[model samples]
Every structure is written in structure tokens, then in C-alpha cells.
Target: QGTRELVGKVAEALASLPPVTVYEPEYVPKPPVVDTSEPLDIQRLDDGHTWLIQGPWLQRLMANVNFDDYESRMWFDKTLRESGLYQQLEERGIEDGDTVSLDGYEFEYQY
Candidate 1:
């Protein structure tokens, strides 16, 4: 025998749904981007934006695990430059989302 279901009686018919249903998007709007140069190390990201980023202690624990470098050093360097170390003091600390401003200069970075 075939797998088709037997038809129900007219009394068993289902009710129709409402033609319109209200919907609200769950998305929260993101802040607009104001461009600044910055560096992002998970360490630094953890430092400045603790709420927005992860903790360094956890990152340090994870860093011990080594991975193969399939990428060139230049790639890493480019990322570092964007981190905004150029504006930071030699002794200053930086976090991934932290913006640094120095004498007439500014940049951003992650520790």
C-alpha cells in the first residue's frame, strides 16, 4: 500500500491563521565606526574592553598551545601596525579596543 494519509472529515479541518502577525527584530544596533588605527592582540583586547573582550589569563593559558604558521610574518606585521603602537608610550599599556592619544597624536591598539 502507498504511504498517503487518509483525508479527514470536514469537521476535522484546521482553522486558518491570522493574515498579519506583528514582528520586531531582535537585532541591537551597533555604534557607528569612527576610524582610528589600532592594534589587536587578544591580550590587549582583554585589557581595555573586558566586557567586550575575553580575559588575558584565559588567553595566556590558551597561548601555550602552538599552531603552525601558514601565514607570512608580513601579515602579522600589518596587523601590528594597525594596533596603534606608534602612538603609545614605550611603557604604556594597550588593549585591543583602547584608543591612545599622545602629544598631538593618536592611535589604538590591543595589549
Candidate 2:
């Protein structure tokens, strides 16, 4: 009898509670614009070298003789020389045989 009375009280209390309100978000659509007039330029630098300069940097491609060496040495050297460390050293008056230390790595400029 006590358990039934308690259950009845709980039901009455639940029935007296106010209803909850819910909110739903609206969706907005966005479309991208693309230009199709200009075509990609594929240039042949030489018999074995070809370069494709696209609109996006990731889309750019290069086919060269000895690509492995080119990627390892030429690209690595170019990117390294263009880095902030190299620029900072240059601004600080770097000279031949000057050693530069950055982020625990050290490099000596010979020319």
C-alpha cells in the first residue's frame, strides 16, 4: 500500500511539471565559384624536363630527368634557403664561413 501511494505521488508530480521547449537550427547553403576559361599551361623546359603550373600550388607538377635527385637536392636546397632562418641570417649580415645555429641545428655558409 505504501509503495502504491508513493508511485501515485510520483505520477501526480510528473503530470504537474511544465512541458519542455526544443529549438532546431536552420541550414544555410553555400556554393563555390570556379573559373573554366583559362586552361592549364604545361611547359617543356628541355627534352627531359616538364613543368605544370596550375592555379593551385598543390596542383603544380614537375617531371624532370633524375627526379629523385632533383627532389632531394634541388627542392630541398631551394626550400631551405627560403626559410626564415636563412632570411634572418641574411638580415643579420651573414658572411662566408659564418656559422648559424637555429633550433639546435647548425649550418655554416661557405658562399
Candidate 3:
């Protein structure tokens, strides 16, 4: 059948079918909250400039960083600086200019 004829036949068939009823769910007041604060691991690499940081929260956070955008990169840096991870890494001998590897991405550590 031609395109227009086929479309018209399909439309007619659909028009003869019963109408659909959409189900609406009730509103939920609040969602259950679970603690996600887990410990992180910092391992020094032999390269002397690279360290591996592993943890669920760190992994999830690192996944959101967009290195190509200056604002996004800056926000990630600021967030790290405000968190305990920065101090912990420093305590673990992470120096300025060192690389921090997380979630398959590498970031430079700066004071």
C-alpha cells in the first residue's frame, strides 16, 4: 500500500480501539534516608605524583566533574577543599602538584 493509504488505514484502526486510561500514583511525602558516609582509601602510587582514592562517595562525586569546563572544575576543587578528604590526603603525604586518581579520572592536588 502507498504511504498515505497505509497511514490512513492505521489511523482508522486505531480510532476504532478503546481509549486508554492513565493511572496516577498518589504523592509521597518524604523519602527514606539512609547513611551513605563510608570510609575512603588513599593509596600512593610508585610514580610519586599519583595516588588512588577509592570509596563509594568519592567515586560518585568524581563522576560528576567536567574537566573541560572551568567553572565545573573549580567547583569540584572547592568541594574537595571544603571536605575532609583534602586534609586526609595531606596527612597521608599527598603534596602539591601530586595527582589524585579516582573513578578512572586523575586530578592534580594543589594547596
Candidate 4:
């Protein structure tokens, strides 16, 4: 019968379809040798800012100043300026207006 033939053809067509495949990614392990013995380089800049550098890492600290209020801004600036870290950076050749680079990125202390 034509219906039986058609059914056979349909079943054959479905059987001819490619098999479905699921991919699983291979895991890669991290290297065993990593160096962390070197000391980090610290820099202090004028304007109550500090910069710390280690290898490709860098940290910058800036005073939190309230820009909308003049008095709050003044207080924040004064507090940061008196910080020992800020003063040390100033003594270590980082000028008040200097840009520092870490991990290929440049940063400056700006309020």
C-alpha cells in the first residue's frame, strides 16, 4: 500500500539523520612554579595618594572627598595628606602630580 511505502520512506529518512554529538572540554592544569618572594614596591604621591606595585599588580589609594561640600572635601584632603603612607610616597620620589603604571595600566590620584 502507498501509505505503508510512505511510512517506510519516512522511517528511512529519519534513520539517515546524523547522530547527535555532545562535546566535553578537556581540563587544563595550572603550572606548579609561581614566584611570590619579591617585595612589593610602594610609592606615595602628593595630594594624599598612595601607590603599591608588585610585579604586574598595582594598588592605588585616594582620599574619599565629598565634592559637593567644600568643608568635607577640605577635611578629607587634610586627613589623607597627614597619613604616614602618603608622606612616605612623597619622600620616595613620587611627585604630587605623577602618573603610575601597573600591569600595563596607568593610574593617577584624582579627586
Candidate 5:
């Protein structure tokens, strides 16, 4: 019953409205622009951490880290420890128990 009343009200409202004329401009195809910019590079942000450039690999790894879950965080840490970047950070003088940050998430480094 309410739906019928709503439909009737909508029809009445539409009937009372003035007509609108839509003007669509001519569609012109734009020339495709070639990419000539340099690719993004990774950088060391601190003694214990480096800034990860946005890429498919980084996105896939970060997608698994859930800050609210302990197990997920542990998995992320283990993954980081197993990766070549861990050795790079160590060579960069990252000490045990030092806080390491990656993509804004911070955690303690352990051997």
C-alpha cells in the first residue's frame, strides 16, 4: 500500500516538473600519451627500515598483513626475515630489538 502511494507521489512529482534538454558535446578521441617518466625507486627511510616503492609484489605482501591479528603480524615478520631485504637492512646496521618500519607498520627486528 505504501509502495503504491510512493509510486503515485513520484509520478505526480515528475508530472509537475519542467522538461530538461540535455546537450551532449561532440565526442573527440584524444591521442594516447606515451609514458616517458622514470620508474619509482625504493629508498632507505631509516637505520632499520626502507621505503618500499609501490608495486605488485609490495601490494601482494602487504595485503596479507593484518595489524589487528597477532598471527598475521607474525607471518609478515617471518616473511620479511626470509626475504633478501632483511640482510640488506642488517648490512645497513639494523640491530636486534631495533624498531623497523615498512609501509608505515612498525615492529621490532629479531635475528
Candidate 6:
């Protein structure tokens, strides 16, 4: 009786998982070369950090969710925003800033 009850509970838990489907979505990768050809500028603003060029560049507008919960989060935010990409990340996911292969395109992100 004990074993049967355990098996039933396990079955119920497993059944809660989602069903798999074959509908795969298309994923466009980022450009092989950013074509930036120029170094980005870094700035320490009063609020958010800015890393970009005068004309074109990648920009990350970050917002700290919980300032007290984690110190690493703040550190990472500061570190990455000061990295090379700045606003030129290959794998960026800032809502509209979806990653797209920059195969020979000369366009900046505009909302």
C-alpha cells in the first residue's frame, strides 16, 4: 500500500510537466562582424551607464531591480556596461534589441 501511494504521487508530479510540441520557431543569428570598425565610448552617468560611439553603437539601458538583494548583480551590471561591446553585444535581448546577424547591414536600432 505504501509503495502504491508513492507511485501515484510520482505519476501525478510527472504529469504536471508541459507536453512537448514540434513547432520550432525560426532563430536569426547576429552578424559575423559588427563592422563597428571604431571603438565605443564609455561614460559614467549619474543614473545609468552609457557605452556607445558618437554616431552608431550598442547601448544597454539597465535598471537595478533589487539593490539590496544581490551585490554581484550590481557588480556585473557595472562590469558588462564597461566591457568592449557596451552597446554592441552579439547576444543582446533588450526587448527591441533582438540579436540579428549583421552580415552586411548598416543600420542602427531605432524604436
* Ranking of models by lDDT: 3, 5, 4, 2, 6, 1
lDDT of 3 by residue, 1-111 (tens): 499999999999999999999989976333222223677788888988899888887666666666896766676776666667788888888888999888788767778
Instruction: List runs of model 1 lying over 4 Å from the truth.
Output: 6-23, 37-111
Cα lDDT, model 3, residue 44: 89
TM-score of each: 0.20, 0.28, 0.58, 0.31, 0.45, 0.24
Model 1 RMSD vs true structure? 15.6
Where does the lowest 10-residue lDDT sum fall in candidate 4?
56-65
On the 0 to 100 scale, the lDDT of residue 109 in model 6 is: 33
Model 2, 1-111: lDDT tens digits are 599999999999999999978878765332222332344333323432222223332122122112355444355345335433345445545666655432223345655
Residue 30 miss distance in model 1 (angstroms):
2.4
User: For each candidate, what is the lDDT?
Assistant: 0.37, 0.43, 0.75, 0.49, 0.59, 0.41
Per-residue error for 42 in candidate 5, Å, reads 5.4
Give one digit per residue, the lDDT tens place, for model 1 in 4-89: 34244332444343457779987744322323333323223334532222333323322332234323323333433454433442
For candidate 6, write residues 28-70 as lDDT tens digits.
Answer: 3432222334565433223322223342333222232233546
**What are the per-residue Cα lDDT tens digits for candidate 5 across 13-90?**
999999989999976443222221333234555543533444444456776667797766666666655555677666
Q: What's model 4's TM-score?
A: 0.31
lDDT of 4 by residue, 1-111 (tens): 599999999999999999989889866343222233334466444543445443421122222333476665465446445444345555666765466544334456443
Candidate 2 vs candidate 3, TM-score winner:
3
Candidate 3 off by > 4 Å: 1-36
Please estimate how well model 5 matches the true structure, expressed as its whole-model Cα lDDT. 0.59
What are the runs in model 4 whose C-alpha is more than 4 Å off? Answer: 1-64, 100-111
